[model samples]
Target: MTTDQPVRAAVAAPGGPRPPQDGPDRGRGGPDRPERDGPPAEGPPAEEARRGFLAKAFGVTALLSAAGSVLGLLRDLLLARYFGANQGTDAFLVAWTVPETAAPLLIEDAMAFLLVPAFSLALVLREERPTGPDPVRQLVRATLPWLMLVLAACSVIAVVGAPHLVRLLAPGLADPQLAVTCTRITAFTILPFGVAGYLTSALRAHHRYTAPAAIYVAYNLGILALLLTCHAVWGVRSAALGVAFGSLLMAGVLVVPFVRGLRATRRPRRPCGPAGDSLVLIPLAILPVAAFTLTRQAQVFVERYLGSGLPPGAISHLNYAAKVSQLAMTAAILIVLVTFPVVARALAAGDLTAARDRVEKDLGQATALVLMGTAFLMACAPSVVALLFERGAFGPHDTAVTAAVIRVYGLGLPAQALIGVMVRPYFSIRPVVRRADDPAATGRTTLLDWYPVGAMALGLLVTVAVGVAATPRLGALGLAAGNAAGITAAAALLMRGLLLRGIALRLPRVLGGQARLLAAGVGAAALGVPAAAVTADPLLSTLLGGTAVILAFAALGTALGAPEVRGPVLGLLRALCPPSPPAAEGKLPHGR
Candidate 1:
């Protein structure tokens, strides 16, 4: 018997080991796969093993995630120190759009959206029919080959058309040839990125977190090593080469684990005729998601395009600002990231209540984290930028402009996090149809909805319109304002769409909670601004401003009855200094 057989059997039903799949598909017996009508073969040992992993999963993932974010920030610092923000960095950044857009499409947004639900659905099917062909393996086998071919071809096209791509991205670039070279080099990231994304989706569905969570750490390390070692020789092109190398490391780290898991299926069952056709969701649903991702990323295109028409350093300044601002959105979304698979599983088991509850709680937690970040980041923008990038080639002027741009961009953190969290529900609780082979089978089929893409397109149009009207006046800050406005608009539209889709979110509660948080945010910002203004030193300003923001937000949030903020503060107080037995039942005379 293979090692995975027992675990697989137990996970065949809802509330079983490995975090449960569903009950409807459980009691299938076969020589290759066992029938698990009760507890897992190893029982409590199995329970303990899975429980231990879940307990440590979030903490471990958070630690690795922090390392990755810190390393990524360091990577940017090295770039500013070594290359500085100039026409050269702008040229590289125009090329940098390749990986920036590709990373989300391949690694985070599109691939995850398409594959996670597909994998979850496959696992459910596998539970239902033990004697049928292994659906998970079947899924990988069916899609991986075609995906490799398409991504490889796309990479080649990118290399051959680098000049045209650069021209389209930034028509008024000072150094078009430099951009072409970087584009050609970074284009190779497409293939490795696709592989890495696919592997991550499969692994996460199976409850393996370490390798996937550590991917960005590997990614950033690769970029830093190569850029540092080769910058003297290759100049800005080293950063482009670093992008390609880093993507390879991302794919490489996940391969061994993926292959090991796939091999655990052992022997495959004989033909289940036409069963493979049932897994059509992967091929069909990818379009709307991919379209959604591409349009969302087109925000970068708009920024660079507008910035291109301005001065030499405009694009570079915008890039630095965007990267720094997104850190808040990134940190806040990690909470949603870990919970997405659980929501998908819940939906797969036909448990909408559990999925809704999970989604609601996620919204609360995500809003709180992002709001706190937005407060601190906005209040301390100048100091934060000065402390991180003021030295090296990035002078006080660069710091000043970038700081302004980042604060303006910070206006969109709430909306961005909203989109990130809300999109999970759309992809998870898909509408299903009956399978061809089994008349009674309840399975999801691919249905493409263009509403998401349409919403993004509208948002992009607004961004461009606002950017044009303001670029001649406010410069990069205007562009940042346009972005914030556009995303806020998009976030509203998506919520409307979300309600129309019939996902019973308590709109009044959600909106009311957000209003309270916004009130707290205003108070935080009001106090935090002057706290920083009191000190000229960047480090001092950052510390004082950050502390003031946190304190004001908590105090105000508690007063306003915002659960996200109050819950955490009260919990910490309880942990540090518990209440002393009701003050000894009216005998609290010592202090009095």
Candidate 2:
């Protein structure tokens, strides 16, 4: 027993424990075990644990995102069950628009853009001289007081002006009651997100992003549960209450972790002046950031305005389609956010070569993924929509409308994805400009400050033009067309920025593979379109034919040299249909 204790100790170590003594190798579990000749068991796990900082950080972000997306899916499904594409649902959608838009602006997007890079630089600096002072603590201290003041002022303004904002949200609406109600409900969303924004930024800066992000997943799940219970008991008001509850819960969850992270890190040094004085300058910087956020909000409000003039269900249809497109976009560029801060820090340190290499690799992968998705969606639009969203209150008319919109959105899938890729690098570049400016002068470039503003402006114009031109004749297709055109223009502008900056994007030599993918997709579409066209029942034909086409395309892509097809294909095959016991190739080395 004493002799075996050493073996047990080795087994309990980090990697896969030692092979079982009870196995066929039981007789070989002697004192002079194979431990000397064989590799150490902990080696693999140790290597995995020794991942680069970004991988560890991003792994957490991805897991949280996946969880949040799942929760969101559940919430939407429940919402759909309770309220199909109808007037009440449309109103709820409009009301939620402010908070929904506010999320990217106030919480995820801005915090991610600003905080991650700052924190990354701090981490890198600490690495250079482990015992040296961290500049971030000072930055954070200076930034915090201003964050609170700005958020507080905004909260007050939002509550006071909720009424007018609602009217602005749906300007085309003739109903005064509808406009007023939307504003009131949406106002509650503003403060919670504002609070969540600051806290989450702090959390992410400390590299504790995963736990905080999970808070959002929890928030969504809570909303889903509350909405279901409330709708059954009290109806639509419950849904609104669910949104408010979720936001508050999100704020609380993020706050606790954020404060803990702050305490763990040393306070930033304030060498020159009073900390209070630095706080005053923080809001001045925040003002432009706030304007940047509000401008984005204004663009979404425009879309809501256009949507309101349509049939009662149109707004809901547009939202649902937009959601689907965004999910695909999210999956494609999920790595971008993770790498963003790393890139930012690299650029700030004047390691432009390293920054370019990282961005280029990430963009290449992103482009391939986006193009692949676009092909799939283009091939299987009708069926994909029918399969995912045809049940509950989503009937044939709803399916047809949503599918049309999704297909149009599909046309610009590559462009929309590249927008995320293009902008994040500029974010890194912006900081360089900020640092170079006179300490007393206005700190950032107007071009850097409002770059997204231009992209969004073009998108808004294209959307309006599409609505006007297409609504009269093509309906939902027109709306989608406008979106596609807008994203395409945005992509062009982004690429032009890259070119002007002399950032060359070397296209990956996946052309042959892509050509194969396109061919397979076309062949699958050829088979599916006729099957769908000939079927008397539109819904069944659409779903069945589309599935068949996608499967056929996937099979062909996999069998060929399509690298993109293999990953998802192998995953699904392994998951849904496991293999039977395999035949032994030969006797064991020692022989039976």
Candidate 3:
């Protein structure tokens, strides 16, 4: 089946993916059915319609992500004002690692990598054999229950071993007790994080994105509310309380839509796919994916580990800087989040060319987006930091430290975005057709294709080595540099691995395009800084710098003949100022 059909967002709508009207389980899509249950819409109109829907989805996601980030910004501001960048904040951030690590496994990386493809395959299977047990429901029942149990058990283990975690993660921390207390509170997030991730995977697989994207908004709102209400009594511990409570809200918001979607589908039969066939291939495939995630995230671990021995507020500075820098990467990554399922479905259909094109396009687009963001961020880091966090207990000294660290993190944003782009194809949806050699039965991608973990492991080791060498003299700056170096190395290796793993992405073109974008970004930053310096006010300086970077990035990109970067810029311009159609014979309609 051609994968370019209008990707109906109703995949999770109970009445969405229905069989023919006369077909069994006939009460198909309820009131919200987008199209009839038949062959898909085709031609240019269909294509345009598809683009419209995807654009809408992307917009909705961007809006929700921005909302969450705003709330998160407020939460960070509250912390900066109340807790300040001190030993207490450092200890609390150490506990924050609980939710951080859990996010990749349960919410973002491992779960989505494993399940989006699985759910996509299940949807395919259901479409193929409509009369049989619904594979979607079957997959959920077989995996979700056991998955929740494992996650809950992990949560309990984390709570029990909070002290051990604190010691291992940050041995030299001055306030280990506070860190331990915070870890114990945040440990409860494992269950909620797992469930939320699982639900997000399921929802996205069915073309449902609103609830998934709203999770962060819900999460940050929860944190902002709890932390504010409890700050006077709870002190720094309020941050941990917010994290735990917020995670619950993350999962809670998705429940109704998840169940509603489930109910709309047909009931399941006992025997689903083949005899003893499984929907989730977690037992085997998860090892490398999980390892890669852990290793990549270990940059933070390494920083805090080494930073613990530094001054009391060093870790806090790194965390604060990282928060600002990540916004650039996050905006770029939204492209991948929306298109990941398309790539998965393409691969599942055995359409390598389609998947290759999709992945390549997404990489270039995301790269351009992030490079521009980096230009703005690195150029305006000082002004941005002062404007956001210089009030209350946070002062000019803290702002200087955070600005320096954030620029280092900003330099790595493109690498982060690239890795996000590449990983989708690395774990593309496998074919559901089972093979005798397939023990996990997930599909073509397997343990032998475990290069990402090794690559990330190498990066983490590099991070550790670099941090150890530089942390003593440079302090948090050294740690920030280590993170940048490691991620850049990993991003390069992952690019080459795509070729080795038969992904068919043209590395020369991709690298060349990146080289051009890098030049454009540098130019953007170079000009943006001077433009920012023209203003004395922090907020005004940031605005000027940000505007200058966009103008420079776009102009320099087009001038350098980088169409991959140019295409998106032109599209945005047209969207803002569409031209009017010419009047026939030079006469305006109904005039004179």
Q: For residues 1-592, could you state the per-residue lDDT of candidate 1 as single tens digits?
A: 4321111111111122344544554423221122232212235664454334444556666778899999999999999999888989999999989999889999998888777776777766665555446667867776788889999999999999998999999999999999999999999999999999999988776656778888999889989998999999999999999989999998998998889878976454554544423544323345678888999999889999989988888888898898888787765667776777767766766777767777777787788888888998889999999999998799999999999999899998899998898887776655221123333232223223667787888988889899989999999888988899888888888887777655688989999999999899888988999999998999999999999999999999999999999998899889999876765575768867
Model 1 residue 101 distance off true place after TM-score fit, in angstroms: 1.1
Clashing pairs in 1: 14-22
Deviating ranges (above 4 Å) for candidate 3: 1-43, 267-282, 429-447, 572-592
Query: How much lDDT does candidate 2 score?
Result: 0.60
- The collision pairs in model 2 are 137-268, 138-268
Report the C-alpha lDDT of model 2 over 1-592, residue by residue, as the tens digit: 3321111000001112223233443223111122111111124543243234445556677777888887887777676667778777777777787677778767866655666555554444433333323344545665666666766677567668766766776665545465456446656766778777766655554445565557678679668877877787756556767787888888887766666555665534423322212111122333334454555455456567777777778878877787766666656656776566556666655677767777765665565566555555565566666666778888878877887788788777777667677666665454311221224223324554565667667766776777678876876567668778776776776666664554555544433544666666566656666666555455676566667676776787778756667667898999999988766687564555
Candidate 1 segments exceeding 4 Å error: 1-55, 265-278, 431-448, 580-592
Higher-TM-score candidate of 1 and 2: 1
- Which candidate order results from sorting by lDDT in descending order? 3, 1, 2
TM-score of candidate 2 on Cα atoms, chains taken together: 0.75
Question: Which lDDT tens digits does candidate 3 get at residues 220-337?
Answer: 9888888889999999998899999999999999999899889988654433334433333335456677887888888988988899999889999999998888888776778888
Q: Which one is best on lDDT? A: 3
Q: Scored by CA lDDT, what does every candidate get?
A: 0.79, 0.60, 0.80
